[model samples]
Target chain A: MIERPHHVPERLGLLSGAAADPFLTEDLLRGVQGHGGVDLAKVVEPLPEDDARWAVEPLRDLVDDAMFQFKENRTDADGWLAPRLHATLRLTRREAADKRIWNHIALAVAPDYVAWRHLPTASEGKVPRINPVRFMGAPDRQCFSRLWWAAEMFRNGADYTPVVRACSNQDLIHNSLRVSLVDHRPTAQALVRILERGTATTGREINGLITAINTAGATVIYDAFAEDEPRDPWALRQWITDAESAPPVPRHVLPTGPDEEPVREDSVAKLTEYFADLFETAPVRGRTP
Target chain B: MKFYPYKRLNRPIALRVMSATLKLPDGTFDPLDTSAYSVPQRTVALGVAQHEDWISARIGLSATLPPGATDADAPWSGLRVLAVLTDGDTNLRTTVELRQDAPDSKEWSGQIEVLRDDHAGRASLAAYAVATVDGVEGRSITETDADWTVDVVSEEPLGGLRLDVKQAGFSKSAREWLRPYADVPWVIDTSGRLPLVMINTDVEGFSDLLGGNGGGIENKIHELLLSQMATDVWTAVFHSAVGDLEVEPDGSPVFPTDWRGEVLREMLPDVAPGLHVEEALRRVHRRRTDDTGWVELQTRIHYAAVRRAGASKAVANALRALQQMNREDSE
Candidate 1:
């Protein structure tokens, strides 16, 4: 694997798509050498010099540790990395929505991590190429972004245990995140619950279940049946405010997210039952009636 | 636009907001102006700064069902009314159940809590009546004909696609990029998060003419000039949006998620009439890349832009003002 950048920025900087495009060369994507940090840093539009939260060393250390720790099993890295990444990189949804920030993270700071994690397994008989979208793409397709959003969407209020569970299932992250229906907290929890209970084990099963839920979502308002507690914006704001002095997320223990109330148990149960029923009738190609 | 197996109310449900209040960060509440709601536009602006310390906004909604809704022999059972607040940007859907006014009352009322964190810009609110029909539970029997736009961030209650307009002295503005475009009265920039119409104040009296809400021929001419600008902006944004779209793994285009998506959704139907927005986008994208039918589609695209800018209406008003002025001079 490629080494960490020689000189990491003190703070995170925005890398516009145009600035980042040239660096996403074919050589870097094929697990080859990427441009060093010195060249990339010259083009980076620096974030506000004053904000402590934009500090890059903490984030660099996190990704470096993530890569080293998960060297044995890369696919497992996502479950470990997602919540920690979110906790470490404190941002409002508006700030997170900016593609440029994520683009910078993937290209300038951690292109090696991108290639290491997403380079396809040697099965297709094609050149093992990493998709450039992983470096600079939509939230769902971009490597770092998908993890951040998965953490955001699946995290039950301040609890990220559900996020870990959701990220564990690759199919859940791959298929479910693209669908807006999973944004509903109860609905997100219910999918995690189904996966935990072994209702849908295979990728195909999970994909079918997600499709069924999304289709049913078009007809029925799932929120009407399984209502979530109205989250306090103050709590989220306070949590973000606390990021400046917050401790680094633990390596072993799962970190707690914002101090907000978790999704109601009854709502999760309601949707779990409803979704399991939907999955049973859903057309899984390999499964027989 | 939606089909259900159950027997539904033929008449549309009438939904209106009865009150709106904002919850502050320090645990106090304040009344939000009722003018923040536009009945004609069917939109309610939750008049609180999203970045401010406000916690949430509670919008009290009243919905009146059609006459047959409360009939004793109605086909459905376990009837319930709900207000669904959906934010496409955040992908959060919140539903609040409404209570009937009396035993067989057609009037239903409830308040939906708008969490500031859950919405980015505009969220949509719609009312639906659901019930068990033919053994299917929680099936939507009827819904509001049009969803009301609940803009969590915007202070104005205007509906439809609204682009940002800013007054900048191009010659001496803080924005360095605008300095190059100083000669022009305005420029349309779609590269940003939203399409911004930068009206250059360097053009003498240009700002007054565009900003003027005065009476007489001046107002008519102002309206005409604004329409012309809008036409140019709409055209530019549409092209910029179509030019830059993400494609799925299967090579099909993925509908954008930002202002590009909104612009496409609003103008695609007009650009490619009778086709769904997604399909229209695909067609337009295919033509642009494949070197076929793109040049021909330019007229339709321009027409859509012109229509959105209300060029015809502006021209008619200008002509009417001229006619009135001619009559006054003769008199």
Candidate 2:
């Protein structure tokens, strides 16, 4: 087990993939060992000092508690960690887009968590290695980016319940997360609604439904059919600001995101009902009529 | 840094599939049970027959002709019976392309198109597309980004006669790749450089498309494409690093002639030395992977109609694609 750094940085910083390489070692790959943040912290180029969002311990403690809570089964920690992480480190898409911050979180803050979540399942392989790509990959594939993006994409405004549901099914996240479609408030919510309804109960079903949704999106103008309210930038700004004095996102229950209006119920219901029908007819390879 | 693994970020659209089946022997079109997408009151089925295609075997969506429907009925009224000509992956295809006209929003609602494939359309099959309606939604026969131009003969009964998109010269990707290369006076360049550029472009695209997905036949084919292009001289030109290439007087690209003469000898030694590249590519037919990456590629190759798609290595892959379709249909 790795200990939390005694010296938590005051602000976040950019940690390039090239810069991240030195910290990843063989023991880290195997989940046998992890390092403290003190040394890794040296490489990061700190963000603006006054930004309250830059605080690191809240983020650090979230992962530490997650590791301890889900010790027997680390992968289960994702559902617990994602929303808290997103709420804990409030930022706009612009801030999140920078790879360095995530690189820092994965390498410096919780390299152990990354390895714990992603370590090889089988002891035997050409080499039991967690891909380096996970350490510094695209926002959707990297260890931390995926969770953050999932929280961003799947969260119903102010409602992390959908995020928890979306995170539960790994395939659900895989098929829908990277697609531009998931970015929509209703599209994201509709998928969760369907999952809750047990329409797409399995990974294969989810994959087929996602593929079908993507295919149909070409012709039909989803926006024209299901209109969304314009986003209030003020709500987002206030949410980020509140992180300064915000209470820790509770673990026992889902947390709320920005206190903005949730997606329209009619629109979600409309897409949900429609998507459910699509899943019925979608081509699942072994499925029968 | 490695790119984040993502599927083609399609604009999410709401689609309602309005589809049915056509029994050829009876010449009757029986509507399959489609999701609840009601047709507009102006028509039972649009007098406009947009697309159509045929396959001997397969179950699922079938096309249908209205009772007593005739060629004389131009824009047939009260005729919901129509045949889906293409983009219907080697099976009975009925593609339902809703209006993806939401320029501002990528998320669409109405009828959701599932299967992500095995459906059909005339000018363009149904897909979640944006930015260029014609470029993306209007192009190609499968769940791909290729465009197809169909002469929807209103008279073609059942709307089923599908024609291949005018051969490769019109392909969008080929246009992008060939536009710059064509302008240069470079000719008689047999250095395998152009092919190398093409191979690299595809490799990069493939990496973006298939990089993160779990292993599948598409990955295998991508690996095969990479290895063959790198090792095989005839094909090596296509896989050469783009930075190192220079144009030839005769328009052939010049690379650092690392041509594996022995590989070419093994495949087609008897062919004239320079002609080997063409033969090697033509030999490469499409083996159907039913992968999004495969569909994207075949559309481009077929569109570019490079040196006659019938002979293009990518087109050769199309042959395998056809075989796969046949297998699916038969199954």
lDDT of 2 by residue, B27-109 (tens): 44434332211323111121123223321111222222222222233322211211122321111123332331243332233
Candidate 2 regions off by >4 Å?
A1-10, A35-39, A122-124, B1-331
Q: Residues A171-266, candidate 1, lDDT per residue (tens digit)?
A: 888777666768688888999999999999888899889878887866676766677886667777888889878888899988888887888999
Task: TM-score each candidate.
Answer: 0.83, 0.50
Badly placed stretches (over 4 Å) of model 1 are: A1-7, A13-51, A119-132, A285-289, B48-52, B166-192, B197-229, B240-258, B276-292, B310-331
Q: List the residue pairs that clash in candidate 1.
A: none
In model 2 chain B, which range of ten residues has the least summed lDDT? B161-170
Question: In model 2, what is chain B's TM-score?
Answer: 0.17
Give the Cα lDDT of each candidate.
0.82, 0.52
- Whole-model alpha-carbon lDDT for candidate 1: 0.82
